[model samples]
Target: MKARLPFIFIIITMMLNSIGIGLILPVMPSLITELTGGSISSAALWGGVLATTYAVMQFFMGPTLGNLSDRYGRRPILLISLVAMGLDYILLSLAGTIWWLFAGRVIAGITGATFSTASAYIADISAPEKRAANFGLIGAAFGVGFIIGPAIGGFLGEIGPRVPFMAAAVVALGNATLGYFVLPETLPQSKRRTFDWTRANPLGALMSIRKIPNLTGLVVVFLIFTISHQVYPSVWSYYTIERFDFTPKMIGASLGAFGFFMAIIQGGVIRMIIPKLGEMRTAMWGMGLNFVVFILVAFLGEVWMLFALMPLMTLGAIAGPALQGIMSKLVDDDAQGELQGIFASVTGIALILSPITMTSIFKYFTDSDAPYYLPGAPFLASSLLEISAMALLFVIAKRIWGTAATPAQ
Candidate 1:
């Protein structure tokens, strides 16, 4: 129990950060509505703008923060980020104008870029063989937070739009206080390196990945898989509502189930599977399974089928931890934060592009006057993308490990 304390603290910190983000989601649109004098469409437009602002800031600042953590130590950076996020929520709660809200979101984005540092912190304490399971724990923490946060936020929003913001602020500050007292610095001064601004930006950070041996292809596969997975989030609610007439309650229930299943798989199943299957084989299995599931989901006619398929869908959660573990092994101790930051930036790029691509595909197919309407077109596209990623992964594996690489010894 004494030895496990640091890991527990890290997970709790991650959960608190995720919960703060989740708390805002259920209330943001309505909050925008009130601020914009009840123009729903305008509110939605501004909401998109606010979201873009956040993502853009994250993309730019992620590497910087990660590099800072490497130089200054993870404890100070993580604590500062938590405190800043809490203050950002407070600012949002008090905002009377749209610009103020934007400012709050910008601050949130900069502070919320701490995940890379958090990943590095986990890497600092974990052995190479154990890193995947530890990273999976982080995913589980996020899953639990997402499950609880929105439910509580939605309930709080009934009292007022700003209620959830204020509540989230309190939660964040409390978590920061806990962290300040309990969180220990993972990166020792001997392992620390001087911060370089040139390699701290997104492009330079990506270039740094290229300099690592045998990692270019793996990084490509990671980016492609990340982008393809965004299809679920971008079109799931719309697809279900259009196809099965699902209510908001049904959608919420489905999401909750997904999060719960993901948590269970990541927290428990992954640790068992990685040792037996090996990281490369496990990742291949996950990507292949996801390809099949995406295609099945695209064509399913019955609502019950969605629920039945969800368990199978959860198997694909193995890919992320496996891939991250492999990447962590390839990099040195000092560069873990930089690697994670670059990956975060890659995710940011995918977030920017996937929503536009997937939604446009959905819209084109679902339109009444389209050449031929197939609501599942976006899913089909996603399946093809996954196949591409799988094929690339296979090629890279063969190139690196020869024929013996399939089962990974």
Candidate 2:
């Protein structure tokens, strides 16, 4: 038990990282309405505001926390983040009104550093060759957590909306306790770098990453792929309902299936494939597979077809870990936290932008007064973005991740 404690702690942290948002999603509406004494639609608008506030704060803080871990070390930052997270969940549980909820979300967002820091922790302990596969474990943990989160939230939501928040509090604080006891500081004093406040925001982090010779283009590729990948979360429910008349239960089942398949591909499949094909080939294959799947989803004719494509749909999970590993190898040991921060910031931007863009496209196409109707238009746009990322990656592969840059194993 002692021998595996670090890995165990990390797995729990990773799962809590993803579970935090999802566990509350199913109950937020009821909670919001209870506090606001408003209509369901008004509660929904407030919910969106809370969600955006959380994302925006996370965007600003990603680099700050990453650089802090770089300077101070991962252990303190992670433990503090976890405790703060647990406290915020408690705040949410005891929230009496809408403003209380807003305050809780704000606190939650500012301290949400677990994912970035945990990535750095993994990078610290992992070898160059093994980094990608280990990164896949992060994905796998997140997938399974996300699948469990909403289920628990929905179930507890029936008893009371506040119940899920308390549940989240327990999970978070318990994880913090485990981490405190077993988690070692992965970043040693000799390896620690000075934390500059200059490169501690989104644009600054991008500039900092830009200084790394081979990573800038890959960052661009990563950004586009992330934005494109947002299609599912942005419009999947709306599209499925508008086109196929899917009910809430059907949507949940489909999404649950997606999460399960993603866990399998990232946890087991990538470990097997990356060893044989190498990170470069593994990434190319996954992104290429994504392009095909996106196009198929865009033009899909039948409800059954989407379900049939589910297994193939998740194969795209491989690209993210592969790309992450490739970039991890290119970066110096000291900068892993910053690199992970860049990835986090990029994700934050994508989260902010993609929903607006994709949903707008979906709205335009599905609107009664539109020029033409195509419910799957957002997926089509995503396919175009995916192909563009593929093209850019192909162009820059040799320059960035080639034999010279990657070095011989």
Candidate 3:
């Protein structure tokens, strides 16, 4: 229990960090639109801009940070991320221009790979068998933060967009100060890997994937699942506004429900469920269920429908840690940093692509009353992609892990 203290602290800090981000997310589009004197479409475009900008920066910096963490130890890296994040939030609160928002997001994205480093930190301390559960706990922290953060962000957004940003800034700053003392270094000098640019660069992670047997298959499965998953963030804000005629606060509240449902499934349920179900089987179940939910979301008209389907969305989140665990099991601890960095980059690629795809579709089809008429095509397409991803996962499992591998033991 004493040894687990650092993991607890690190996970808590992560929760706080995500909560800060989540709190601002729901209201951001509307706030930016108003601030920029742009159309709602323009607002939605900026939302993608902010996210893609962040993801692009993350795509570039994730491996670098992870590699550096391996050499310098996780404590300093973690602290630096927290401090930089807090400053990012502060800058967000002060932004009076659209460019300011863009700059803030760029900083936040570059520094936000704190989670990747956190993964490396968790790996540093835990045994192989325990890594899945610990990583699951990290996933749970994100779910909990998203659950609570949106509610706070929604409530505060009614006062002003800047108000929520200020609040997020304060929370981030406070977490950094507490984390300095509470979070200890997990990677000792004896275990540190030498940073190799060939293995740690943005292209290097993908290029290196082919050299490792079975890893390419796993990465392929991972990439497909992530691309479908990226759709929600890339388009949901615009979806809610156009479909339900929701205001910023209302959007925040709806997203809050989404986060709450995620917390229930991934945070509370995964711990109990994973030990019984096994990771691969559990992930397949999650993907199949997500496919069903997203298909329904495509056509559903009522705001109440989103509430009803939130649980389904939550169920889909189970794939993440399950896959993360699989990746951890397949690789050695020394390479966990590089492997997770590659994982971050693949997801970043999805983040990069999902926006341009979804928003273009939305803009082409969306009408003032389209939500009542046809809100299902994008979601339906997303569902098909999910189903395809599940098929790929199974094919990968059989081809790589062999027919002897079963999702559930």
- Tell me how candidate 3 scores on lDDT: 0.79
Local error of candidate 1 at 358, Å? 3.0
lDDT of 3 by residue, 7-75 (tens): 788888879977887889877876787788966666766787777788888887777788889889998
lDDT of 2 by residue, 1-409 (tens): 7766787788778888777666776667567768988644344346556766777778778768888999999999999999999999999899998999999988998887556678888888888898888887887788888877766665666678788889899999998898898999989899999999875757655668867877888888888888888777666656776678654445546666667777777668888988777777777777888888988998888989998998887888687877788788889999997797688778888877776677677767766676888877888898888889888877887665454223222
**How do the predictions measure up, each by TM-score?**
0.74, 0.71, 0.81
Candidate 1 least-lDDT 10 residues:
38-47
Winner by TM-score = 3
Per residue, candidate 1 scores C-alpha lDDT tens digits across 143-176 of: 7987777666666766787988999899989988
Ranking by TM-score: 3, 1, 2
> How much lDDT does each candidate structure score?
0.79, 0.77, 0.79
TM-score of 3: 0.81
